[model samples]
Target: MSVLVYTESEQNKFKKAAFEVASYAKAVASQLGTTVTAVVINAEDTSELGNYGVDKVLKVSNSALDNFSAKTYASVLTEAAQSENAQVVILSSSADSKYLAPLLAIGLNAGYASNVVAAPLSTSPFKVKRSAFTNKAFEVTEIQSETKIIGVSNNSF
Candidate 1:
């Protein structure tokens, strides 16, 4: 199974968080012994993702997705993850990602971990370290589901 990452963009240009997530995905993919696949929505260029260790890029262009609708974005990501057979899905901790995370998790029937500060600690039991209580504390969470969704904190990687 591959590791899937959502690369967020604005005005057809990828945001900084996109690269951060891509890098984080690369680390996760290495731990999982798989490649990294990035999904870009309405982006103009995706070649730079390769520099961040993205193995494959899926570019999706649709006017209907120009506006940010949590439901619509979640649907698209869900489809990409399933098609890629992604066991782990990575997202940046942007506001839009936070909105989309739960929807995507429910759609994929995966466990959701937000504010992740680092790459997974273990892949067998699917454990990750995440920040809690406004980053004042940290917690180790184990996702029992076959599919896992991790929202990496901005600049954490």
Candidate 2:
């Protein structure tokens, strides 16, 4: 299975968190012995994602998605993940992503891990390091599910 990442954008331009999530996804993909596939909605210059180790890009150019709707975005990501047969989905810890993550997780029936500071400690058990208790402490969380959704903290990679 491939690792899927959501690359966030604004005004048709990719945000810094997009590349950061891509980098983190690439690391996870490497550890899992797979490739990274990124889903970009209404974004431009998708080729730049290749520099961040994205193997393939699924570009969604729809004006209907210009406005941020958590439901719609989650639907699109869910389809992308399923089509790619992705077991691992990566998202950046942005405001919009925070809203989208839970919806995506439920749609995929995946275990959600937020505020992840680093890549998985082990892929077999799907262990990851995440900030806990408002970042005052850190914890290693194990996702016990067939699918896993990770929300990487901003600039953590």
Candidate 3:
């Protein structure tokens, strides 16, 4: 299975967060011995994702998805993850991604973690270290689910 990164874009252009998530996912993929696949919606160009070590890009440009809907976007990401056999799903901690992360986790029945500051401590049990209480403290979460979802905090990398 590969690592899937949900890339957020607007006006047919990718945001900086997209690249960050892609780069993060690439590092995680390297640790997991898998490739990175980026899932983008309505992006005009996905070639730039390769610069972040994204091995593949899944671009969904459906007109119905032109507008942002958390539920709809989560569903699309879930489907893309399943199709890609994604063992790990990474997203930036943007407002939109925060809304989508939990929905996508529920859809995929995967364990979810937010504000992750670094790579996973372990992948077998899917242990991750994340910031808690607004970065005042830290928490190590162990995810037993087969798939794992991570939301990277803004500018935390």
Give all TM-scores, in the order shown.
Answer: 0.98, 0.98, 0.96
Q: Rate the local accuracy (lDDT) of all candidates.
A: 0.95, 0.96, 0.91
Clashes of 2: 0
Q: Write the per-residue lDDT of candidate 1 for residues 87-119, one digit (tens) a residue.
A: 899999999999999999999999999999999
Score candidate 1 by TM-score against the native. 0.98
Tens-place lDDT per residue, model 2, 1-157, is 8999999999989999999999999999999999999999998789999999999999999999999999999999999999999999999999999999999999999999999999899998899999999899999999999999999998889
Number of the candidate with higher TM-score, 1 or 3: 1
Q: Report clashes for each candidate as comma-separated counts.
A: 0, 0, 0
Candidate 3: stretches off by over 4 Å? none
Q: What's the lDDT for residue 34 in model 1?
A: 91
Q: What residue runs in model 2 are displaced by over 4 Å at the alpha carbon?
A: none
lDDT of 3 by residue, 2-83 (tens): 9999999988999999998999998899989999999989988899999999998888988898889999999999999999
Q: Which window of ten consecutive residues has the lowest lDDT sum in model 2?
A: 41-50
